[model samples]
Target: MERETESRVYGWEPGEQAGRTVGREYAELVGGLLDGQLLDVTGWTAADRAGGVLLIADLGLYGPGGRADYAPDDDDAAGGLFRWRGDTA
Candidate 1:
């Protein structure tokens, strides 16, 4: 791409430049946390100084029935049951 066109997308405004390096590092760290070989799918894209990339990944598991179950909730927020056993955070 022409420098002019490239500049338009990756161009750093006055403040955005400061976060560029940090954001790239953070993305990498997140990608590293996942195990691609064990997982069903993994994807990545990146740019040089002007653009950023996102790592798309998934386990590719699903129920063919497409049925979901949920429990009723109480006002106290303690009575509700979680579907996922692990930490959502």
Candidate 2:
């Protein structure tokens, strides 16, 4: 007899670019923290940019505890460079 196993849906893998288009469209975090990190901005639009948006980043430091908040670096929003906002918890 075969034992039952659990299946899970894992989102973007580590170091994986979240966006569909690699370099064409995506949010990349620059500077000291989260540098070179790419995020999915598929549906993100100008309206969202005007209101400001917060993105959650998983640093993988200590599981969920390692997650943190980050926002677009307004100075370079067009460049898709984000800045470290603060810790999640």
Candidate 3:
């Protein structure tokens, strides 16, 4: 059966000299955390820096949905629930 998934997208920007090195490191880190094989779904792109490479990664979490069922109040003094979620930092 199909299930709802949570998605987190991250952009890895490795400066001109070490794109390949950075890419391998990131793949290893994620593989270790999931304890499974990591597939290479990466695409080639240019970074903002001259001659840099950009790798975009999409991390998906699949399971029963509960976190998205509730919405946070955006009028909090601390600038909403996202503030603590690292969206502002």
Candidate 4:
């Protein structure tokens, strides 16, 4: 998964809640992506947690341009994400 180019990271606040299962899945996904060095990852943060059943994990990822623009509405094309579409995604 080593990317050809370097990537950045960004954080996101779902503005609601991700619970535990979803958060764990998300964390695992992110951790895998990061460990594999897949693409130019952005929005990565050590604070991203997924332990409790009712908590908010401020996750992160790289946007289209390799930056956390916070514009979750931005298209996945602009970011490296496959289904990125704001917090609702």
TM-score of 1: 0.15
Give Cα-based local distance difference scores for all models: 0.22, 0.51, 0.23, 0.25
How well does candidate 3 match the true structure in TM-score terms? 0.17
Q: For residues 1-89, what per-residue lDDT tens digits would candidate 1 score against the true structure? A: 11211111122343433322312321111112221111111232222311322222232122232222221122224321212111111
Kindly list the per-residue Cα lDDT of model 3 for residues 5-48, writing each as its tens digit: 22221232323222233243212112211222222224522222
Among residues 3 or more apart in sequence or in different chains, the pairs in candidate 3 whose N, CA or C atoms overlap within 3 Å are none
Among all windows of 10 consecutive residues in model 2, the one with the lowest summed lDDT is 1-10
TM-score of each: 0.15, 0.53, 0.17, 0.15
Which tens-of-lDDT digit does each residue in 1-89 have in candidate 2? 22222211124564342334433346665543455655556677867644444443455434454555556687884746557665554
Residue lDDT tens for model 4, 1-89: 22222222223224322223212222212221232122222344423221111111234343233321122112333332322223311
Residue 50 of model 2 has an lDDT of 45
Strongest candidate by lDDT: 2
Who wins the TM-score comparison?
A: 2
Once superposed on the true structure, which residue ranges of model 2 sit more than 4 Å away at CA?
A: 1-11, 14-24, 31-33, 50-66, 77-79
- Candidate 1 lDDT: 0.22
RMSD score of candidate 4 (Å): 14.8
Model 3 alpha-carbon drift over 4 Å, by segment:
1-26, 29-33, 46-62, 65-89
TM-score of 4: 0.15
